[model samples]
Target chain A: MSVTAPLGFRAAGVAAGIKSGGARDLALVVNDGPARAAAGVFTANRVKAAPVLWSQQVLAGGRLRAVVLNSGGANACTGPEGFQDTHATAEKAAGLLDDSAGEIAVCSTGLIGERLPMDVLLSGVETAAGQLSRDGGLAAADAIRTTDTVSKISFKRGSGYMVGGMAKGAGMLAPALATMLCVITTDAELSSEQLDAVLRAATSRTFDRLDTDGCMSTNDTVLLLASGAAGVVPDLAEFEQRVTEVCADLARQLLVDAEGASKAIAIEVVGAASEDDAVKVGRSVARSNLLKCAIHGEDPNWGRVLAAVGTTDAVFEPDRLNVAINGIWICRGGAVGDDRSKVDMRPRDVTITVDLSAGPHTATVHTTDLTADYVHENSAYSS
Target chain B: MSVTAPLGFRAAGVAAGIKSGGARDLALVVNDGPARAAAGVFTANRVKAAPVLWSQQVLAGGRLRAVVLNSGGANACTGPEGFQDTHATAEKAAGLLDDSAGEIAVCSTGLIGERLPMDVLLSGVETAAGQLSRDGGLAAADAIRTTDTVSKISFKRGSGYMVGGMAKGAGMLAPALATMLCVITTDAELSSEQLDAVLRAATSRTFDRLDTDGCMSTNDTVLLLASGAAGVVPDLAEFEQRVTEVCADLARQLLVDAEGASKAIAIEVVGAASEDDAVKVGRSVARSNLLKCAIHGEDPNWGRVLAAVGTTDAVFEPDRLNVAINGIWICRGGAVGDDRSKVDMRPRDVTITVDLSAGPHTATVHTTDLTADYVHENSAYSS
Candidate 1:
């Protein structure tokens, strides 16, 4: 179960004939609730997909009764006709669900600069809406995958309430958000304003810190919906914590399944002048292609780490920097320290700790090692 | 002839026994000039190499009698001992030439973080100093090779004067200069201030635009020395142009020899509100691994181009953007335009033109396509 793990949520998935080989390409989730509230975050890239634009408008109204997602086409860079198609999709979904078009959110992923087969998609949407059930969460999650090897789902039980989420992304993962679409649902009684604040806080710490390839996408969207069917007015602090836990779980899942990744590396930056400085330093280190390759090769090349750190403007003296890999202090005070050969990098998970020795702030950024498989996967993606 | 193509210059290369293969790894270039005017630029990385630190101080005096460069070790991140090695090398070269250490510069390229063999290097400097001659430019160029397969040399004859240069870099090429060591010689009668201004202008338009792999190095240095032996006060504008031509030729050579690269891409951003915006847009597109991979696969994936353009703060409306690969405009008004199939990518050289449709300003950035070979080269680099 994914979204439907939360009470008052029903979901379904259907083959839309939009994707080749007749794979499941469409999904729907409905809020069968006494109250409906929603919040959303979209890609920071100026060029946004058609569904992202449509969903953003619906979410701005602070109420959503249903969400319809398709994975055959991103509908980005398709001009005015793409936006019209997205509008038509929402209108069709609302007509079948007996709700206003403004209450239905739409999301799309897959190839950009292409038009979706609207007839097949609309029919698939109708079939999915009719099949919506409490146990259809897993099916819905499975439908929204492009190059993803597996569907991502997570759930956390709260104090007399529950929160759950599903996400789909394989590549183009970077700051602000990955090239991903995530829908989180909860049965706790909370206002749309409260949901927005909690979602922003959770994503900023989790999703925003993931920089797999340093490539920002045009179709990244994360949504949160609340249904009051649980009839429990949960404590705000506990609610936020549960939501954050679910998001973190899903984010880690994304990391583990990053495209062609051989290692999952965490760059933890500490002793910074400020939180912003820490994040800057961590992101700089995370984006280094050479350092990522060294990690892939199991070479404890701490010099590349320091080279990456030196490229940032964060407050720190070069000679005061320290770096550790796998708990082995390979570089101390900006020079070779502990024997690098003693650091074991045979494991898939690697942690690099950087001490700026400037202040007390810290941040951790997650990334994947650069590999030949990544070049192979992305080179043939569009073709 | 490389740097020695200009009058009043002598150079030599010798085996330093520091490299494993006993290859010629030490080079000495002496400006046997009546005038010793010099100008230099170094890497922008804050954690600079010891050689860069030493050379900057020597160049600050506006005079350089000789430059000693060694391969096999970068002398970077080696703590105080690394600085000491660079100082000792300069002192030995200056002593051999009966000059002050402040007038001698040093350059090192290869693996970072390992201390160089000081005794072997000092002796090799003595051999190089004794062998210096007018015809030793080619040997000097060959000695600076790390991963470089061939030596890079360029020369342009001005009215009664000449500008010639040699550069060594195969990977880690990026903005604010590359992981390269370059020595340019000119016989034109120019002051140190004139040399500094002209060198900066020429490099900003040439070497600074080459960004292969987008990784800055800790030891990037470009030195220009004027021997003023031609006894000709060439026109300043013509001299700058000649120098820029030589720099541009060497930059292209670096691009062609970029490690594991199969295609050389020139991303030209036109119709920008400002030149900086144009360069920002061009660089963003050039750095996109997705786009680079697509180019390598010979696919006209214009959508990746738009995605990269959207990531920049450059002045452009999403719908008005246009991109053309080779001469075919595959994207216009941010949508699919002419037939992508018509774009031929069979050649090693590729040109991608992006039209921001904002203003008349424009810029061009040079880069290499991402490939599995790149991953292989960098992964095993420091091992």
Candidate 2:
């Protein structure tokens, strides 16, 4: 159930003084392979972190041997100096692993705008490299946590190859990929093109659908590395399925652990004018603070849902919209329909379905309800 | 300091059992008039409240004798019955006065999806007409409030005329007019076209820039009535200036009294490519929940500001952006610039200045920080 669950992968986590709280803040994952194929999906935010910039350039060759990640400083908005720090971190990792510096990828998380503690980070990377093992995925996942209460790890067993992944995120989660750092490993004989296609598809359906807070981060990065150690060239479709399953599992974990969230909601928008419209209406409902607040209080206030739907450009009449929560038609034809008291929201999982009554396209977005704990956790103190 | 400050306005407030809480939930304002030229702006929300729909139809003839507003029910998405309720309220107000129902406007605010109690609403309108007096503006303002801690009232004195207004709103505020109801009265003679132009301009600069919680309401309405009671012909420019001043004053009061807000933040975006771009950038920063949370915690977390700016299409170099908090330049050229600890945030008034360095256009938006109180007030068992 971890990244190292896949064959031909070695991983480790190490503590560095970089985190003043005295926790593990550095991780190393190496592909000890006969095949080195890699693909990556970085943050959509224009103001990206130094590591994101470095990794995007490094992946231009479609080859990667190792990855080094840290969770102390995001190394974002730190100017040219921040870029130099990221470059140095990659060079240090390459030196310890007998690999080319250009073939190494780097990821960073934690507070933005501060320079990383270079000395402590390099020492931790050296220690992590020495401790790397086939069963070190759990430790590597632990090292990447920021405010998350638990590390995320997922694995999907297949006919021949296996898919494994790890992720860490608790805030600034929204579109185009959540505020997250994830690394996936697979022991399948797939080309770089195959890896890229599956990675993008898997992430678009998983990471890009988590909108816990409607915030886009500057340091989101997801990487997929393939090493053909299973000695079987699996069907591309089968491999994509397994990769998507692993990502789906990781996304659910991230949503469940979203900071201060009490209810994990799945919003489905059907009968829209287009796929984009469906997603737009769904996101509008998912991000409504009033609706989220009502859900947190367990109030089946479907009026807020209709109000949110009205804010979008989706094709639907004010009198034709319909809404259901937990299979109860609380609103139909944009007015009161069924008994709202019959709907139950006592559980952590909630489903809200909106019928746009326009076309047949549909989309789903996973979100969490707003709670006082959300404000308390986010506004308590500075990192 | 209220609607009565103007020369020709008579107002009243009466108890309406429509609100189960037994608050003063009904109000009436009459133009004791010689001149009846009027103009109004209603909510941009596609799913508008019944009162918004009724008021738009009533103001189409460029005349209005009185306005009747009620709290306790938004009468939004409540189907055709809600429209009938609004029509009945207008008819009841006109029956008590020597005026036509077509010359009466109506507005309602409170929880959405519920139908207004027609019996209570009509009775309150009749009683309000009987109690109308020049000193009743304060009571009328008090009657419109739902969760507002204080009634919002403002008066702008001119050389020969005065503009006075009253507003009620504590939540569901955003641009294109906030979740607010405002009635402005003046004694100057003006055409309906002139009134429409000036009211639009005033609202565009004032009420449209207050985005407390980024949720647009279904019942936002602003009305302007001129009675020519001062027996003086005021200059159009002078009257417009007074109208803008009154709206600005009311906007400030609304921000200060925003539900559960801990601080009032003024966000100014300068050096944008256009006025629209400046406003767009400023609003993006104002609506960022992460930045609001940091402000509530009193931390100068400028990185969050940069993250929000990146989400927009505003023209600016990623490394050339700058930000200031209070009087300290905390971020310069997209990097750390000031001693963050030197900037104090103990005051309730906080100013965030962003320098886009793209062009010469600028705009400002007023907002509030997210607090645990905001979440508690919004999610506490639903109003």
Candidate 3:
């Protein structure tokens, strides 16, 4: 159970020939509530998909009655025709669900610069509307997968309330957001303003920090809907923390399922003058292809880490920087500190800690090692 | 004949025990000049190697009698000892050549964060000094090989002068400079100020724009020495152009010999608001691993190019963008244009022209396709 784990929400998944081999490729989530509060975040890339452009407009009203999502076409770079298709999809879902067209949001994912199968997609929307159930959360999660190997779902329980979410992404993960589509639902009593504030706070520290490949997508989106069916107002501070935890769980799942990844690596930068500096340092280190390849080979090459950090403009003296790999201080004072052979890198999880020795701010960015499988997977993706 | 092709110059290459298997790893070039005028450029990375720091100080005096270069180790991040080793090497070369220590420059390339075998390097310097000859430019080029497949050498004739150069770099190439060591010698009668201006102008458009892997090195150095042996004061503009052509030739050689590269890609951005904007957009596209991988697979994936352009802060409207692969305009007005199948990619050379349609400025960045061989080479390195 994910979105449906919360009360007053119905979701369904169905195949409509949009994806070949009759695999499920359509999902619909509807909030049947006394309150239809919603919030969303879209890709930072200026060249956004048509669905994202439509959803951004619909979400500006701070409400959403239903969300219609499809896989197999990104509906991007198709010009005005693509925008019309997204509008048509939202209108079709609204007509079937007895909701206003302006209250419906749409999302699309798959290959870029392609058009969706309109006839199959609209029919799938109707079928999903008729088959909606409280236990259809898992099916909806599975339908949005492209290269993801498993369904990502998480639920966190607050006092007399519930927060649940589902996400699907594999590659092209970067800052602002990964190439993903996520739907989150809650039964806690909250206003549109409160939901928007909480969602932004949660996603900023979770999904925004997961950069697997450093490639931003044109179709990343995350939406949160509140039904308020439980009729209980939660403490704002405690409720925000629960929402953050759920988002963090989904982000971690995305990292674990990243395309062709053999190891989940975290670059933690500490003693920065500011949070931005810490993030800058972490992201710079996370994007080092040489360091990623070295990690793939289980070599504690701290030199590559310093080289990457030196490229950034963050405040740190070269000779004062320190680095540790897997709890072993391999580089201290920008020189060799310990025996690199003593560090064990056989585990799937690896952590590289960088101490800037500047201040107290810290940040962590997650990424994957560079491998031949990654090169193979990406090289053959568009073929 | 490369560096020694110019009059009043001698060079030599020698095998040193610093390199395993007795490969040539040490080189020396001396300018027996009536006028010792020189200019140099170093890596932009703040965490520079010991040799870079030492040479930066020597080059500040605007005169250099000789250069001592080695390829077995990068002598970087070794604390005070690393700096001392570089100073000692330069002093030994100066003593052997009957020159001042302040007039001797040092350069090194290879693995970073390692100490050199000073004992072997010092002896090799002595041997190279004794064997310096006018025809040793090719051997000097051969000695600076780390992962380079072949030596890079170029020479151009002026009215009554000669300019020749040699370079060695295969990977860790990025903006500011590549992981390279280059030495240029000229017989033109020019002052140090003129040499500095001409060298900067030439490099800014050549070696500085070749970003093979988007990974800058900590030990990049390029130097030009003028001996005034020809005693001809040529026109400055024409001389600068010739120097630029020689630097461009050496830069192309570096691109052709990039580590594990299967395709040499040129990303030329046109119709930008300014030159800096054009370069920013081109470099952003050059660093896209998805685009690189797609090119490696010979899949004309223009959507990846658009996605990369969207990530830059350059001035461009999404709907007005266009892209061409090789000579086929596969994407026009930010959407599909000509049939992608019409494009041929079997050739080793590929050109991607991106029209921002924002203004009239233009820039080009050279790069290479990301391949399995690249991943394999870097992954197993230092293991």
Candidate 4:
């Protein structure tokens, strides 16, 4: 399964001179189908980019034929001019595809508070439309990238249809959806409500669990367009399951590409009185810079983890808490357990477990360790 | 006005080999009192150090004579033995000062989850006690530090009394407090209730408003001891004013010495519907790593600021919000206001102003920028 596995969809990617390194920075994907059902999730951040706002309004009716994306300028904080640019770009794509402007979605990534070059953007849209092909899915995935070291794409095969998606983000990532910009294509015949329900459920557990630095972005967007090109629609449960797999795969890929990330960490909080408590405890540890740095150094600093949990509103006796790092029980009943010297944390994957000893409720949050390279990359970028 | 400027107090500092660099790592200050009223504020973190638990219990009675602090080995997560080490250290200090062990407060900083070398600690306590002097305030201030670039000490002379304090912390500093340890001494006769009232009031506005990375610490403790040796007790009004000033000064110094700090930022939120709203908005900006990094680069990224505040529960119209960076109004009513280029942010001191246009409530939170040096220093240190 690949991004092009979805039927009745054609994609094209191009270089548009938006990025300094001449990387692919323009993409176009069109639904050449009998179905136009669409759903989208955008950044909760109030300071949204022009494209995010524009695409959100476009998706409100649950109908979309195509999407145009570019990487370089975020088109955020550019005032009315930025919104006008997004509208104009959408109109240009609409003209080439002979579709209503409102039926087209737009997304942008890269430095924030910068305006997109209208000339380059308009020309790039034309080029992308001209180069659109059924086998262009890989190119589309590559175009919508910025600081990401590689493109993120996921796919899942269903009994009658398929789900495919491409995402781009490295830092400024958090549960509120981070700075990610993603596009998903499907060949399942689904309504607006059904698509939204499945998308929300999948996102809640996938994208929402990827927290690198706990920083929300102003240009985050994820759009799903389903074209009834496969001529078959499975039951809601089956479609939802496949959707979840695709989202989870993309989310995992995003974590793997997290900026300056040395390891992918899974922080699990178990035996909590409630799921909320478990999630709260897990997020607290996921957001602790000290703990993340410790993990980066492979020090297995369970004390920092305990301290993080203590700061949460979760009910737990300090002495009753137990902690494990990388399968080694380093602390038990709120006291030091086994010798930390015996724990090995050199692997790229790390797991931290906290037993609250309250009940059976549990939750797990995915995160990445903090490293100097993360700081260097972020500080060097204008965004 | 130094730590020793307060009446009825003598302080001393010495090298104890606790710090790998052999810097001053042991400090002692005694209340040669006619009045020994005291109050304390400790870390809210659940994974507390053995010394924090001991100090908290001893301070419950509001009577303290001396405080002993070391700059290396936090003595946290060391299990029962850590508790024993804390008790032994306090006992040694009590023996030398001819006071009950419970009356002596102990604090340890540096790497977490590490055990103290009891032999070296005992010898250091003895050396600190013998080196105690009336004018050893500066040395004492220098000794109780870890990862701090400079010593933090502030003093104020009252009509007939004096107030002084010393503090140490770098990162893991936030509103609920960080890895901080502070000691305040005064020569004003006051009851335990009075001391608690004044200290709480001062802390709520001063130390609580200093948030670096939003990571609360496990060993944050602030001790205030009063001795009536000066035979001058002012009214509650004057005492509160003096205490507030001392706390404010110490808080400022802490911000100045923040780890990997390249700039000190003051985020002021005004015209909120309530003080809580103001604090929430201010803290949102203070805790945003992206905003901090943007500020570090001197990029007036007001969009990130707005995005951060948007995530808060504070009620406000997006277009009704106004923001200013470094005295230049960059955003008005949630849109571009002026030329961002005019807002020069190259200086180390940066101020962000947000107008909620809801009411008269306001709050100011102090924070530091996120930088590569911060990540480097924190990740390089092995727990």
Evaluation by TM-score, superior candidate among 1 and 2: 1
Candidate 4: residue pairs that collide: A319-A333, B35-B228
CA displacement after TM-score superposition, residue A221 of candidate 4 (Å):
1.5
Tens digits of per-residue lDDT, candidate 4, B64-149, equal 99999988778877778899999999999999998999899998887776788888878999999998888988999899877777
Ranking of predictions according to DockQ:
1, 3, 2, 4
Tens digits of per-residue lDDT for model 3 on A141-224?
988887888989999999999999999887444221236888999998888899889999998898888887778888899999
- Name model 3 segments beyond 4 Å from true: A171-178, B171-178
- Per-structure clash totals for the candidates: 0, 0, 0, 2
> Comparing to the true complex, what docking class would candidate 3 get?
medium
Q: At residue A334, what lDDT does model 4 achieve?
A: 76
A148-243: candidate 4 lDDT, tens digit per residue: 778888888898888998888874442222369888889989998899998898887778777777777878888888998998877999998888
TM-score of each: 0.98, 0.96, 0.98, 0.92
Number of the top-ranking candidate, with DockQ as the measure: 1
In terms of docking quality, how is candidate 4 classified?
medium
Look at candidate 3 and tell me the lDDT of residue B27. Answer: 95
Runs of candidate 1 with Cα error greater than 4 angstroms are A171-178, B171-178
The local distance difference test score of each candidate is 0.89, 0.87, 0.88, 0.84
lDDT of 2 at A20: 89
Model 3, residue B107: displacement in angstroms? 0.8
Q: Model 1 in CAPRI terms: which quality? A: medium
Q: Give the DockQ of candidate 3.
A: 0.61
